[model samples]
Target: MKCSRCDRDAVIFIRYNGEHLCAEHFMEFLESRVKHELRKQVDLKPGDRIVVGTSGGKDSTTTVYLLKKIFSMRRDIEIIAVTIDEGIEGYRDRAIGVLSGYLKKIGVEHRIYRIKERFGKTIDEIAMMDKTLIPCTYCGVFRRSLLNSAARELDADYVATGLNLDDTAQSIIMNFARGDLDRLARLGPHSVVKEDLIPRIQPLRMIPEKEVLLYAILRGIEFYHGTCPYADLALRNQFRKAIDEWEARSPGTRHSIVSVYDELKPLLIERYRNFKLNRCEICGDPTPGRICKACELRLRLDKIQNL
Candidate 1:
């Protein structure tokens, strides 16, 4: 099929929109939406620093790449790529190498933090220590903690993530299904800035996962394609599978999920607007509870080691 916008052959047919786009139009289609999303998420000023939680995957690589491209002329805006090393041995180790090289090649400053460094054990070790909790249970808490700490340490104005439409939709449905209304309200791209917790920005929040992968390939962005060794055990897997099935059965299902959530999120946030955040007594991160979830998990790990 010919390109929807030009004579070139269509590289991919977008089922959600029913458009056949070539390499040029596909990249443009992706970038333009990201630019719109980014603009809606933040109002950048001179010297405003943005830290991206890059995982060396297609989504993250595209996020960093596009952010750099969009703001290339804005010399005053500083963009840094931060990678979390969850210490999954060959998996995370190899990703950081690819991430580092990519960041270097793109002229973006890069940094890496490890879960083992501050938490006293790698994710791999923690998984072995506790067989009851899923690897993602530990990983999710540790990664969020480390990423926030990394942002605070760097004094960033905003923390960027690579969450795409699929991830966004799954999270919304999962939280709604579990009756986690507050968490549902708190999903990013975040607009509010909380102390010690850098608000997250997701440029790819509206983009689909497959589109991101194709864009990365077409743009020649180097990214690690390895799956996590413990991925099969994630609680999110069930949600992801369900959402994927829905999307396959109904084109634009993901978009409909996010769009409806977006419409409802304002009311959700307003309902919880007055709920206060308390500092984690141990780590001082912001949380609605007395102790942050990360510290709570860490305390559990400590008790396990003592036992």
Candidate 2:
């Protein structure tokens, strides 16, 4: 099909927006939308540092590359990449290598932190401990804690992540389904939970996952294509598959769902903003309860290992 904007053959047809775009226009659309979303979240100033959470996947690879491109001439704004090595042997090791090489090539200062070092156990070792516990339960809790701690240690102004539309939509659905109003309220382009926590900005949150992958390829960004070995064991995989099927049938179902959630987010935040937050007694991270989820999980794991 011909590109609606030009004479070139179309590379993608955005059914929601009803536009057929060639490679050039597609790139332009993606970058412009990301920039708009980014600006809506936070305004970067001189001497501001953004710590990007890169996993060497398509979404993160695209996020880092675009951030550098957008602020290429801004000498005051420093972009650093941090890769959390979960030490999953065949999975995380390969991705870390790709992430390291990419960061070096782009001249971005990068850091790698291991879960084993921080939590005293790698994901592989934790997975061996208990058959009843899902791996993601450990991963999600540990990763968030590590990222927040890393951001604080780097003294960054903001933490940036590559959470795309599909991920957001699934999260919204999952939260609502599970009656998790507090977490649902926290969903947005930018995070504003606590003072000690660095605010996280999601520039690519409005972009679709497929488009992110396309953008990475078109921009010649290097990334690891392998999926996490334990990914299929999570409940998220079921939601992901269902959401993909819905999008395939309804064209813009994912976008529509997320857009509605975005509209409702303001009201949700206003309602939940006054909810009390306390520091985890163990790790001193902000938590709704006395202890944070990460510490709770760690205690459980430690107990299981002792037995």
Candidate 3:
């Protein structure tokens, strides 16, 4: 059937809060989200460098594509693509190939930093060593450190991530559930970059996951379609599945929950400042403990092999 919205032939069905959106309408939805977020959080000046961490997955790949297109239209910004190679056997390598091709096609400069070359351990090796901890948690910790360090090395003004609404919302729920006001207060469309902190910004903070997937498909963007093999065993996976089921029952349940959190953000901020921030003695990132979680995890892994 020809889509009423974009005249493209409709394939997959997206019932967005009782409104039927074909793939093309879905793409518009995602684009609108990106535009809204950009207008909200970003103010680009000429020659300002925006570094985007891409994994060639649906979210990050779509992020790069949109940012490149959007920034290319304006004369005020430079976009740089950086992909962290986590050394996941079949996944990261293939994703790197796809991302490189896309970047080359559009004449965007891209950098791929491999974990094996930078760190001594592959994600798989680390996972094998730390079987008790979820693999994603370890990967996330290492990836964040790598991304921040790389952004600093690149001398970029802002580090952009493909964290859409679903990811941010899930994190909000998790933090609230754990009473982690410090982290929750820091969550928003724009986070101010501190001298000691490499600021990470999410331009698609309001876009839904379903919309992002549709955007990737409609734009013919190449992405890692397979789920992270280690994701099934993670607690976040359980939370994601639970939210997915809820979304099926109520089309925008996740968004609604996040909206409520946003409404209560001021109170969250008050609670956050009530607690004093401390520096990690090891890495010096803001942490309540003497050593940050990432450093602690790395030291733990190191000791395990030594034992």
Candidate 4:
């Protein structure tokens, strides 16, 4: 196909908007949106540090790459990449090898925190010990908790993540489906900060997953291509498949879902504004109830072990 904007052969067909873009234009299209997203998500300041929760995957590597690309000239703003090692040996170990090399090649400072180091168990061990809940239940809670703690220890002003549009849409529908309005209201690219809990910023929240992959490839970005062995066990898999089907049927469905959610987010936030977060008595993390979800899962794991 001919490039929609130039004479070069098109490298991608942006189905959502019906544009056939060549490599040059495609990269420009993707990076420009990411740059815009960064600007819209947070207001950067001198000496402000951003800690990125990088997982060495396409999305995360792209996130760290683009963040450095955009802020490379700003000596005052610091960007550090942090990876969570969930102790999924075959999965996380290989990815970390790629992640560390990539981050170093890009000259971005990288740090790693392990779930087992903090919680006394890895995701794989939790999966083997507990049969009722999925590994994702433990992995998600532990990963989020570790990321927040890592960000705090690094003294970061904001924590950026690699949540692209597909992930964002899936989360929205999943939360809405489960009647988790409180969680939906508190979804990422967070502008408001709660004490001890770092606000999240998503630079690729508006970009599609395929585009992120293609951009990573085109830019010669090195990221781990493996999926977690336990990925299929996630409750989110159902929503992800359904949303993919919806998006395939209707080119713009993903955008529509996110756009609608973005429109209603302010109202959702306002409705829940009065609700206050209490520190978890066990771990001192922020939560609505007396205990946070991570600590709750840890206690569950401990009980299972005792039995």
TM-score on alpha carbons, each prediction = 0.98, 0.97, 0.89, 0.99
Model 4 lDDT per residue over 70-140, tens place: 99899999999999999998999999999999888889999999999999998999889999999999899
Query: How would you encode candidate 3's per-residue C-alpha lDDT over 80-152 as one tens digit per residue?
Result: 8899888888888877887888788877789887766656788889888886787788788778877877888
lDDT of 2 by residue, 1-307 (tens): 9999999999999888999999999999999999899888898889999999988898987889989999999999999998888989998899988888988898888898889999999999899996888888899889988988999999999999999999988999988888999888876555564658688899888899989988888889999999999988988877888989998889889888888898898888889778878999998989889999999989998899888
lDDT of 1 by residue, 153-193 (tens): 99999999999999999999999999998899889877876
Name the regions of candidate 1 deviating beyond 4 angstroms: none
Supply candidate 3's per-residue lDDT for 10: 66
| Clashing residue pairs, backbone N/CA/C < 3 A, model 4 | none
By lDDT, the best candidate is 4
The candidate 3 region of ten consecutive residues with least summed lDDT is 188-197
RMSD of each candidate relative to the true structure: 0.9, 1.2, 2.4, 0.7
Please give the distance, in angstroms, between residue 146's alpha carbon in candidate 3 and its true position after superposition. 1.0
| Backbone clash numbers for all candidates listed | 0, 0, 0, 0
Q: Residue 150's C-alpha lDDT in candidate 4? A: 90
lDDT at position 126, candidate 4: 89
